[model samples]
Target: MTLVYFPSHFKRAPAIFFFAFFLFTLGVTHFFGGSVSLLQAGESKAGLPYIVKKGDSLGEIALRYNVSVTAIKKWNKLTGDKIFEGQRLRIEPFPLHSYTVKSGDTLSEIALASNIPVSRLRELNKITGDRIYTGQKLQLVNDRKRTEKPSVHVVEKGESLWDIAKQYDISIAAIKKRNHLKTEVITPGMTLSLKEVPEEKHAKEKTDEEDPELFEYKVRPGDNLSTIAERFDVAVSLLKQLNGLKENRIYPGQTLQLRPTSLDEAVHVVRSGETLSSIAFKYRMNVSDIKRINEIEGSKIVVGQELRLKGAKPNVYIVERGDALWEVAQAYGMRVEELKRLNGLTSDRIYPGQELQLGIAPARPFGTYTVKKGDYLGRIARLHQMSVADLKSMNNMKTALIYPGDQLKVTPFLQQGSEWLKISEINWDDLMGSSGGLKKITLGNGPYYGSRPMARRQNNRRYYESARLSLWNTYKRAQKLQAALDRKIAKMGRLSDCLNGWHIVIDPGHGGLDPGAVVANLDGNGDKVYVVEDEYVYDVALRVYVMLRLHGADVTLTLLSPDHLIRHSDPPVQTFVNEKNEVYNSRAFNRGNSRSHWPKGGRNGNLSRRVAIAENAFKNVPRNRRMLLSFHADIDHSSPNVPLVLYYRNRRTGRPDRASKQFAKAIQPFLGAGTVIRGQNVFVLRNSPADISVMLELRNLAYTDHAWALRFEELRQRDAEKVVRGVVEYVKGKG
Candidate 1:
């Protein structure tokens, strides 16, 4: 080796070299440390396992990670866009392994080298076929080892090969290949190698007969033949054959043969637009069977989820708490007798957590069948080979009434004993008279209570008997009257009867602080006066309320006069004190912000509160006998419009409700000749709990004649009377 000597400043050569080395070392350290710190910060900011902070939204997080909100939701299985602080989210997709094509490398060769299925590789890269090019970067799923050594799974009772694969997050084919098994059958108490096994070595192993190892498992709670087969990675058929079982009946503490059988376990990954029912149809498996194997509590699943397509047997149901045999049969669309026959049930008695074997039968298609013209309940029932009572029970019908274009269930199972009568059995005379032993009280613009008379009398026993008889007589008379009215209405083809015994709820749109469509007008003194929509509608509603009550129709108002107190201030805002002693601005109610303003009963803000009040009244009344009418006055600036009626229709079917349309059409003639009955999906009518709901936009305040009519009490009374006539027609038509 030859050495070169430094000539200039030779005395400090060693010191110079030492200082240069120190500076170089410091620079290297700083550069590497900074790079590491930056990498860690980037990971913390937005990456896998990101800890959510306050004010973090899904959109913000998605933007940070360059991902879509939909992708994030899919990854997290979120049904809605709601997240809370401190919740951790997966901000990044799973890391993909990249493979660069080299010379002499083919797609199949690369996939084999990586020990991944060729189909999987193609799926990951979106490749159509075996086409490839050199130096191409192909994205691949990461094949990282889950564990250092493969873990052994002990066979359990009611376990199947598919179940084992799902538990270990491995494919059924992979498990079968690792165990050197031709079939998916495995018995309980048998130890199986989860790691890959050499085919030659597995072949060399002794057979079950030569080993003579006692392979038996005791059944436990929630164990049935299907579940046991799933737990042991075996087929239910093999278990039955080995145990000499003629049926799917199994009990706890029972011992069964633990031998492997021949069956293939198929795995399927859920995709978008797939439902449990559809999945079951694809696999030719019963929906309940699929649910049982997966231990699913509800019929909800997310995309990209791995599901077991095999090992699900048909007609096996695990009894849930509060489950009755009849209910179970109905849920499966099977008759009670058929269910009993399949299960060999001698009695209707069944307990919670009991497993029943519903033997496989040919699948029957259950769907809606449209009612054609001239079809009656009895006729349809006969066509479907069901009784009228059964048909009514299946369709939840309160009356034996069906109309053309109505979609009715063709093969729906009847619910056991949950039917309610359309009309109540009450004596009108006993309820209205003093001696008949029942008294009624007025509450909230309607009769509320009907109770036994409290007054003491010498003939108390006679009075009680007389009241009972009177009630029965009254019920019979009302039924007869309703039948007669139905026939008359059918013959007349018009509504022209008093709305007696009908329950009606009237909702006046906009009240209190919500002026609603304020229009400037001149008073008698030439001062500007504001004609608010709420005040006019309220006045008209009051008149209608009185008219309906006079005709013996039960009436309820969403907002009473006492609740519509207004204070004329500079801002012209209304205020009210709630039960909690909180003063809330009525303006906030109109804006639907009253909940935040009051914190108590604030949800009853403005329009929503009015809707809730109407719904509550409807609930208090009977279902078919109740109707809701919302009154509103519109201001049209473009053109002069006449009075119009609006009603809601089913959005999915695009068909207006028959009753609501009839009610609207009945009132149209009374409003004017040019009045139009429109189908509108308004908030009140669309969401009302009543069977029939209608909204009346009485007259346009912008028009001269309409404004004059509303301003005069006599004209308003005339409109109210027309409305009463329309309602009477509707009630008569319903009968």
Candidate 2:
């Protein structure tokens, strides 16, 4: 080694020069997207490990891994962007446990792809809207499911696959494949395992079959032709042609069919000067067929426009009010099974204005058949998949007697059950007492409770007094609550439409794999009943969602429950189950309520997913117009657990936001006596960009308290109304 002697001043100058040179190199490399960082020795290796080298920076690494730079900082305990050469860094939880937003990304897509519940994502990220942007950082969490016995279901009598699926919220396709079921037929006493996933997937659904995963795209607030087409992976031109769109206008709630073309059809591009007639002639098809398939009007054809050729439009029939599958099939002279197959219907449910596809061929002669030689009534009924009795009824035949030359009605009308008047049996002995049970109330020409003939004076009313008292008390409570709400609303003026056009998101707390809290007991009939936190909260959330929507606010739900399309509960949901079946709206609940299928993390990821969902959902709306209502129930072992309203506050200031406080106060009065109003920096609420975020703990599930609030449908409905009234009141105050 050669050594040069130098003075102390000169040596210090050389060191300073070298330090300056190093800073310059780093600045140039980072700005130009060049990797220059080198890993330093003794740096901790935690999370997904990475080594720094030439042309490496936080931004560059994040982009490569499709993660947010902030996430890298958090995982690596990084305080700044400065990284040294040879420094070992933690880059994990990046691609492995976190997701970065991409252009045109929706909360649903991220939830589905990452196997994290969208609600969990929203909760973690504190998202209030469905709108997400490119290059945003999102946290992923582990789906936490309680350990329990292996999930197995026994077939019950009178239960179909559809019924079982709806009850469990799992797709039929998933269940069938799991149990190796060859058809949708199962017998009682058969036990099936619902836990294990099939290694080999079944054949995918055809273009026309209704896909259980997703059948149609329900247009959202800001959807257009281009966005819808891209999301469904179809061409814009093809979408327009298939949906019969003459322009690029669509409204929210419009159902757009993604796949309508059959495998037999081919795409044909319209050349300049070519008319629909010319195209039909070239393809050996009729002009009418061309027009129908292409959704074309008149003879105008644009250059480079794509049109489906040789595609015949399947016959479509509009379902009128009160129309049933049997009626439609009978009118068209087709079998019910054939009609179901043609329209991809699984159940007998039909709503007014629903479009159903009829078979391609012309309808055969209806309600009449010419008897021929060797033809029997039984044979004709068998051919039509109808019962002999049904055929006889349609033909108005008294018996199976038939003549060879007689014309018989072939189409059978739907069987109607004879309406038997309901006879309510009254037990006079139990209702009346032998003594003077009704002496005071009975009408007579003598003193009220005093006298008459020995037999006629007897006023027996066994249950009359007690029953009357009980009914009177119940009615009084209901009347009191209604009056209180009325008085409250009257003070606020005409505010029925206060929520008009506002964006509201209702989130049910603790769902899917996480049941939150479980209270098991027996019902009046000695059958097991559950007051599950998630189940009860979901029902209440659904009720609020419906009420808000009816008030003209654009309302949506953070998670989806079984039979979710039901806006009104007919008999109301009186029972709660401890099934892990609720899913964040965009992903399958079986995707493990995201089992977040993620590697173990610090906390359950479901809430974060929910917060993220809310954030993205409210992203497009103004902060003032955005609101999130998270519904929950408390398990109180002591003390009266009246409804509790928690409003979001800033931790530093120790005070709630003005809007959130107002919202809480407006709702406080209606939430029953002793309604507690709290202001705190709640994780779910504080993260929301919305001006108002309130968490409503609707009921106290304790034996001694108001536990019936969870088990009684009537009580639950009342609670829902109370919360809705509060919201309306808040909007009124703002107005």
Candidate 3:
């Protein structure tokens, strides 16, 4: 049976009832978590299909599978020992359970009930969203073994290892070892080895708890900390310390760990979005110390991966062919001595397959030497504390020849008043005050930075003072009020001068043949309705053009009308000639005559035209000007009510053209949230010489009322105003 779900109107009780029932059923499923096979049973030499009835239980499933009732319940993790009707259970004859979707289930909700994250659920179901309708087959966790064993309890919100251990009569340490927990702190979705445990062994294990063993606990409804603590016989403080929990409150699906002796040796779980540097910073320890303790070599950590803090070095790397000792050390983000000591290497030369130690190398002493023109290895070595042979050896150099660009590594003899200094993020004011400040400056390294020198040349970088005065009060007020907004903050003394006074052009999308969206009339005249996306766009463009021009910006259009401009020109098309262009052009050219549309007219319609316009606009502007923006309208053909906006990042030419992803980030939230996202490659912004170019999708005028259309027009005008405002801010160096 195919199950189709119509979106429930959230106003009624039936929807709420179904949703609650589904959650309840899922929660109850934890009891019978494994599978049973009927194929092995004599009951089914062939396949058989069974429909579920209201009063059926595990016994019926087992009978159907030719397996025992115990086997069926154990297989499916059914907590209530019962089943319902209109329910279809698969009799695979093999020990496997395939869950079928019920109404009102989201992927996140299902994943929570199944003791996993949405990612794992997606992997299991091969699904991307909570879009499953009733009757959809979903692969459940596969477990074939059947015993008198109790259902496995996963650590859920608000539960602790102690409670779980007591419930299952198992030792916390045994559970920890089974689940490979390093700390007493566990998380929701961690499966615990719950079985019929011996009381004496459990008691003995409890008495010895030190670095307590971690285990899983399923949270029961209405269970609180004080209640759970008394039941588990573990200190609430100990539990809190184990979980890094600040509050006593716990959720229904949270998992907590418990140990026998002392609280478990403190450890941290590397979570997603956490880097080793960040972890080290958070723990107030050096990254090297954490790395040394956890034995982690690279920055690869998946969410929920545990790290032991009991100080252990990671495995040493073996030197192979084409490996340089220093290079290898650098690869490990360490020094040669660190690598040598870790692997116990006593010599400079390392052959293929030679074992090398790996750990955080101890910090080295200060070293420095000035370069003497025309001085070779022997002279340079003598000036420093290193011998000629040692210098060559330390630097891994086979030759004595040194060039002007070569840096000599030397041991330093620190004298009084000698200090190392850097400009440390040059300030805009100071740089602007100096002559030729933007002329690619080299401080420590050659050609460190390249920037435009206009700030220095004009000596007008002081304009920031006035701009600052004008905006600071406004900014503080906005911040104080906590206005709904997006803000970008830059540290240090200077802003990007290259982005100032940028001349950008906007290209509104889908004009001419592309009569974009067709809105059916609610009236019963059989009257068809249509909106030429380009026409709506042109309205937007004219408003934008006037606004941008008023703000002293240079603007251009790719196409002025529905008639032939670049599309009808020779070379067959004026822009990006790809499949996307062809589709867009065909759509536009076909207009309302859907049948006469040219499928291959051009790929990525008007892309080339837009790019050409931007290119021309950029060339026409002064060398100091910046980027471009292409305007467009959202279209779904499926659901036009949900609009979309997208941008392009760096193009193939290595230019910093605006990324569509950024545009989507900037505008998507404004479109009423949760809009569908898509990517496109067009020519205009793609080919522009500007630092960045963006394509903006304004709105979906189809299916919109007259009021909505007016609002959309207003939004377009506001967006245009924002574009000019952003440009002015950029030019003033406030952005």
Candidate 4:
């Protein structure tokens, strides 16, 4: 609190001295490997060590180096919330929510340490395959706490945890953890622990940081800036900046980007000569990365298509024929003249051979900055080496319009701690393994719908009342994960060459804990006959796994043996139970002795038991390059229920495509020998994620008729083969 007033007579002298001292200090800083401010606004230097690229999203950039999009935007004083290729983004010296794969650390272990979901970890790091190798950089996406924190303010009269969390740029979880509170309630004068964090908590905290919640998105054929931005809660301007839009456009064969907090999600891009393997290699990523990014249950990438590349750097746009210079400049936030100058041109005329810079153009101003999660304008300036006014001027921002994916210009500086460190090389095979989004499109007229026919439910005549509730519950869970899966798959799908590479985890239901049906003693001996559900499912799953492997698919099985899976309270089951009783309608409970028989554990040898086991197994299988198949033996004693199959469908809305039902169709024919009924009321068959899931009921395995049992193995093997065939076909079409 010391204030000295300037003397009137010496005012000019003091001003001159101050100016000289400032200049001298600035010179010394630069001479000593420090940065000098070349910008009139924004921070004085870039902190993180990476550069934003074309097809890059704010979330991807943040996850790459374990920072927050908000922090990055704040540091850069970014307006319009955009990023560009070649635009330098600040990185902390050591990342908080990231790890360099150690020799023994599995993906699951890494995810656990970072307090992030395994699926999120896979998507954040663009892992296309299973396994993590030594020296691989894996991102844990739960580190938003580093960038976003609760603020500490004296509680006034009436305040809630939600209100407090909102007040301070932090989440309710953070506040609860900081204050050691049991619930989100607060009391006056309690001195609640607020997350009054610094500008870039993600960068500031270097160790033991949890991963932030992250989402994945698949690139679609007609995806563009506006559509993706709208879906993910991101600004269109920000998307353009992160992706380095040489032209504000996107194609079908590319991936998308996303974050936990961003409304508009993240995305990726497609490149020439890029296969799943190549894409994985270039990004030090995996084929699974491509699959996850593109949301291709089967590997498929159309020409000029856009997939999802969540964690990898945004893609670069190659100069193409019939392009305009102005369009390019506007897309990348550069002057038309700058484009001309960068390409050594005097006029606007351009050529394909010129290879105009597609991503962020070169020549960035310097500065030091920290990124914040969910950061907006007005807050970034306070934490960095720039003033708010300066930031506006430097970034050419008229208002406080900013988003998470912006890079700011700043003065240069010497080496200091950063959230990101430079990595010179990336090994693709070690990171992504062989899995991606390259599949063939069935343009020909032979069985245009592939193996399984659309479920009988599509006809809308035989919708089961109780079954609809059961299916809707399961479908809701899948839908909840759909957005995230889409983001991951889109990234993997862009590599057409990588289409042949696919890591597929297939789950066949009714193993271990689930015995679906029970039979009574006809002789009156009071002895009960238990039919084993696991036996059939185990056989089917194994065959499918083998067939898929033989067909060049990298396949993993949820239960290779009866004992491989146990009845567990996780995943689809958990999701179903969590729903309101009204939504969790189940016919099994209404069946005689169903509730008592279908408890949590023990091999009951019933169809319901088998279904539960399969469902539980799916819960255990991580959401990376995966699909779930609940195999059942149908039993409809009366004609009312008949013997038809069903596939789940999402309520009609903006999202189109039979993602759920198609999977059922893919495997239906193999099970048709028992009883062929087509329908769409099954919950397991709804519009779920790219971990394509469906329920296949072998027509009459439960019937006493020997014909049903005779066809059991045939149906099992065929179903397995079909699953494999479908995956292979998908890969071929995409590749």
Using TM-score as the measure, which candidate wins? 2
State each candidate's clash count: 14, 57, 56, 166
RMSD score of candidate 3 (Å) = 27.4
| lDDT of model 2, residue 559 | 64
Q: What are the models' TM-scores?
A: 0.29, 0.32, 0.29, 0.23
Roughly what TM-score does model 3 have, to 2 decimal places?
Answer: 0.29
Listed per candidate, the RMSD to the true structure in angstroms reads 30.8, 31.8, 27.4, 29.7
> Tens digits of per-residue lDDT for model 3 on 1-735?
000011111222333222222322222111111211111121221222345667766664554343456555554565666677865554443322455577765554444333345676687778876677887766655344323334355454556888677655579987776554678887753555544333233333432221111233434468777665544434455455445568998765445554211113224434323566645643456887775554445654432233443342245443322233443554344665666555544432333223355554443343545464545554455334233444665576766667755776664431211131111122212322222222334321111122211121111101111111112232233232111111111222222232335576666565433434322211111121223344445546645554444344545555442111111111100111111111221112324323233221135443454455456667756764555666665432222223344444343543332343434434332232123334445555556666556665555432222112322222344344434433444454323
What is the per-residue lDDT of model 4 for residues 587-644, given as tens digits with 9 covering 90 to 100?
3322343333322233433334333434444454555445555555433322111123
Off by over 4 Å in 3: 1-501, 517-532, 561-607, 624-626, 636-680, 689-691, 699-711, 730-735
Q: Put down candidate 1 lDDT per residue, 1-735, tens digits, no spaces.
A: 000001111122222122222221111111110112111112222234556779978887765443467878877888899999998776543221466677656675455333345787898788989898888878654345222322345455567988777655679998776554679888864545455533343234443212211234555567788766654433465466455567998765455554422111133334333578656754556899876655454786543233454433455654422234554565566776787667644434332223467777545435477886655564455334343444676677876668889998765422222232111121222322222122334321222123222321111111211122222233333233323322332332111125655688888776444434443322222232345566567667866765566556777766533211111111111111111211221222323333233212223553555566666666667668888888887653221234567789667776677678867755554453234466767777877878788988886654323443354343454466557756765566556
- What are the Cα lDDT values of the candidates? 0.48, 0.50, 0.40, 0.37
**Candidate 1: what lDDT?**
0.48
Candidate 3: minimum summed lDDT over ten consecutive residues — where? Answer: 568-577
What number of backbone clashes does candidate 3 have, counting pairs of residues 3 or more apart or in separate chains? Answer: 56
Question: Which regions of candidate 1 fall more than 4 Å away from where they truly are?
Answer: 1-497, 524-527, 563-606, 637-640, 650-653
> On a 0 to 1 TM-score scale, where does candidate 1 land against the true structure?
0.29
Q: Candidate 2 local accuracy as lDDT? A: 0.50
